[model samples]
Target: MSNNHNPAKPLQSILAIMAHPDDAEFCCGATVRQMSDAGADVTYIILTNGDKGNHNLSITVPELVKTRMKEQRAAAEILGVKDVIFMGEEDGFLQPNRELRRRLVRHIRKIKPDLIICQNPEMFFSGDRYINHPDHRNAGLVVIEAVFPAAGNPMFFPDLLAEGYEPHSIRELWICMAPEPDHKIDITDLLDVKIQALRQHESQFDDLDEMEKWVRERWSEENEAGEQRYYESFKRMKFD
Candidate 1:
């Protein structure tokens, strides 16, 4: 329950993989703030162009994608993220395929992140209207696969090996919105920074008033909910 980490030095390099532009901000913004504030290098890889996110807007698909990417880049700057990568896949239609997995593995090996953050794949809350997005689930599965056997196993991607991309093992993974959370990061001191970073994604949350209210309510719920401290929750993928 303490936000006191060694702030003078970088603790770890974190790579966050998500399906859309604002998914990370909505789910793990506070955790990102905490880690960045403590000098941890953070990078984000958005799997889709987020072209379908806008409603009642006159922009074309390419234009919307461009706009969202710009917004995400600005948001990353606000969150202290070192780099942002877009996979250029179509929005709302992601699939966990070998091609995507290979691409992710190459980046994983290149970045060599100490930790990776992603969305949950389980369906525990589906009945209660907490149905996970198909794109999110697919991305989560791909990320898990890429982080383990694909990225960590050099034999899995021989093309990467030929290109001098060495296999790298990540120390840990944090899945935001996990059905079962084994890790919690305290973000009380960095809540305002989280809000600011999230606000940068103007394309996703166009209604300023509604977005602010929703964020506040969610934050309050996460804090006041029993036995759940103000933190980002995740289930670590343990590979032996």
Candidate 2:
């Protein structure tokens, strides 16, 4: 776990691992913008193509995948992200397995990000109102495993080491939408950037205005007990 209690310290690099194209934008776009704006290198790892994102049965998976990939690139550019890597996995069917962990470990080694951000793996259900996507939970668990023993231990992924990717130890892991968040980043100044980034994913939303409003209200609710105007909260786990 991390020894640093101060959340304001600037991290040199940040990597966001998410299940779909717009997950990063919806969860932590402002945070990514803030970090990148502060001169930190930011990268995105999208584990799925988001082909099954559209509810309309008429839309084909290949078409949706291409559109989602394009939107992801645009969104990443808007957030000042240095790179957006797609794992080419089928949407809605991600699994936490050795192959997935090995792939994630390779990226962890290659990126060597100081901070790794992802979804909450344990958030399966939310008060009957919503059910967390299986892909999101799987991606979270995969990243958590990859960041720990797989990425840091040289023996875990021997092929990666042989391929010239060195073991990289992450300083912190940040899980978004966690049940208990220990860190909150005030993102009032970057809210507009986040909204704009989300707008890039036009294929997913029927009404962008409503989407933006819901996001704003959600984040605002997180700040009702704090002094921060608009905030993004995360469960921070520090590792040596």
Candidate 3:
């Protein structure tokens, strides 16, 4: 009989997988900051180059990709993320395919994250005219699929075994910007940290005044809804 009583050891690693450079910051920044402060190791896997994000820049695809990658690395550093992986998928054209799932599964197996955070996969918006982006939805769907049988099943993705990737069962999944949220993490003290981290992506938030106002208002609304100072809300998915 094996004796294992410490539960905290199993919950150390966390993974945040998103479609674009700023998706994680916009959606779950506070949660990431809180988890990092709590000593959890967080890793990010970005699925796109975010080359199509800029509207005014006269940059080519390769140039834009390089710029966005640098921005993403800077943002990750500000958020205290330990590692980041890029999928090298084309921006604005991501699809939920077997290849993507396999790659995601491989990473999940290697990282063995206890908690996975992602954007909402559903189409409905939360009374805000801002519909979630298509790439966000696609990435979320594939991430959920990878967290399931793909990463946990030994028979699936057989090549991963040869690559030394083992089966990993994630304990919980939190989907940000979900229409219906079931879990809320109090981020009262971490709100500023989150904002500073988001500011690292200067390419996206060149209009700092407007972005700050928007984030403050949004966080205020979330605070009112939860009766807390600030929090990151999420809809918990069925993990079993």
Candidate 4:
């Protein structure tokens, strides 16, 4: 991750599919920013509206959804994301099903991205002993399936084709918070941008400084072990 300028052209487009509003920011904001700065078109597909992400018992679900959506848009803007798509699924009740796969496939075909970024499908338990949310896990599975035969095979979703969305194949996929990562990006130069982008999710966090400190502490370990001052890790999957 030593800022190795390969002189190779960057991938043209990237689509990040995640569970909630802040999932993209918490998991891969730095990496997304780095890609955008390098001239890659970055897009986000948020699965849920994050209706239940508040501890305030007085707030209504609709109110929380609106607030979270606004925060997520602001955060995406900071990262230079080209577009944000919301699936509008219910929070905390996500299920990996054919409908979810179809919707995800439709986006994949429409976006026609070279790289698809998403959460790790296998990460059900955190090393910190925190139980991973089922919605996150569900989104991961749906994304993985959507990136595969569902998106590439026209027969799987013929209606999408009728709507003018042709099958689009994605060759490279990256999984965030993967237990085994084979790829790493140096984000040292963009740490400030990443922290700032993450701060946009103000609704989810009470203390921005504490969140920033947590990010530094987590990435610092990877930075020290790798060849870069700061790095974001990913498990790379290749279709070809």
Candidate 5:
């Protein structure tokens, strides 16, 4: 277990596989920005359209999906992400099914990313307050299944081979919100960028100031010098 940067090779490309539009922004925006600044090409694979994210009954599902995708694109742009791919799965109903796994495998082989940052599959509940979203857990499982025997093994998806998405093995996987995180990336200097990226989800948050305040309070901590700092922790796994 190592907290410092543990990838044997410098990251050249990164792919964030997540459940919803703002998932990447809320979880790992600053880290993505930092990596992009350091010359890594970063792409986001949003597994769902986020159609059920809003409480306004007046808005149609199609309308909400469009709004969220626009917001997600803007947020990824703020984080300097190279591309954002929306998988358009129905909101609140993602699954680690064979169909979804094949789709994810196609992307993994096509992107050939050095690092894949994803959700945590086993987070069922948080303390006594929040029940983890089903989509989140399923999203994590989808990525895990794809990254294993499916994406790297040519035998798993013979059709993808014809599509020219060759088998590609990843170097590392960083699971966000992991219960036993062994790696923590300090983003003390990039807190503003992280919050700014998240604020792009206008349809999701009613009060920008309140959201910003909550985020700072939730993610910040006092250092030995009594100065506040920010970091995102993950369970990192390296491959052979």
Candidate 6:
């Protein structure tokens, strides 16, 4: 995340596709903030309504959905994201199915972002303590599938083309929480910005201070000379 080790450039536009409202914030908030600061028009696509994330039995599913959407918008605004699109897929039951892929293709074709940030489709589990969320894996798969063979191929969805969402292909792809990340971007300066964005999701956390502390300590690293740094790593791919 230091020096020329990074991409050394800012993109024209970025789209972060995630399984839930807070997923993008947790995975790539700081990176998105940096990109937006550098003048990238950033848009977020939350694939699920995030209705199931709350444990409060008093809150109904429909109410939670509306609340989460509001929180997501506030969070995205804080990060300078230009737009937030909620796919409204049921939480926890997302699948990498044809319907979703086609829908994603339509969105991708319309957004026409040069860079896309997504989660890891192949990750079924993480460390010994956690099993990766099904929605996360499925969301990644849906994005990748749409980006490939679909969004760029007019034949995949002829209706989309007729509707004027002409075939569009992204120039670069970045996967967060990838098993093997080859690149890291320094986000040491946007730590506060990231925290503020995450804070917008008020219904997700019971203890805000504790959550903030965890986030700070999670990505912080110190060099030999006591210089602390933070980063967001990604698996990057480019197309000619």
Q: Which is the leading candidate under lDDT? A: 5
Candidate 5 least-lDDT 10 residues: 1-10
lDDT of 4 by residue, 61-159 (tens): 888898898999999999989899999999999998999899899888988998898988787798776898989888889998888788988898899
Candidate 1: global Cα-lDDT?
0.80
Off by over 4 Å in 6: 1-10, 223-226
For residue 159, model 2's alpha carbon misses the true position, in angstroms, by 1.4
Worst 10 residues of 4 by lDDT: 1-10
The 10 consecutive residues of candidate 1 with the worst lDDT sum are 1-10
Q: CA lDDT of 73 in candidate 1? A: 88
C-alpha lDDT of all candidate models, in order: 0.80, 0.89, 0.82, 0.86, 0.91, 0.90
Which window of 10 residues has the lowest lDDT sum in candidate 3? 1-10
For model 1, state the Cα shift of residue 5 in Å: 8.1
- List the pairs of residues colliding in candidate 6: none
Off by over 4 Å in 5: 1-8, 223-226
> Candidate 2 overall Cα lDDT vs. reference?
0.89
Give the residue spans of candidate 3 off by over 4 A: 1-10, 222-228, 238-240
TM-score of 6: 0.94
Candidate 2 per-residue lDDT, tens place, 7-80, comes to 57658899999999999998889999888877889999999999888989888888889999999999999999
Clashing pairs in 1: none
Clash pairs for candidate 5:
none
Model 5 C-alpha lDDT per residue in residues 1-240, reported as the tens digit of each score:
112553456788999999999999888999999898877899999999999899999999999999999999999999999999999999999989999999999999999999999999999998899999999999999999999989999999899999999999998999999888888777888889999999999999989889999989878877678887788888999895
Cα deviation of 147, candidate 3, in Å: 0.9
Which candidate do you rate higher for TM-score, 1 or 3? 3
Summarize candidate 6's per-residue lDDT along 119-212 as a digit string, tens digits.
9999999899889999999999999999998999989989889999999999899999988888787788888989999999999999999899
**Candidate 6 lDDT (Cα, 0 to 1):** 0.90
List, residue by residue over 55-98, the lDDT tens digit for candidate 1: 85577888888888988988788888889999989888999899
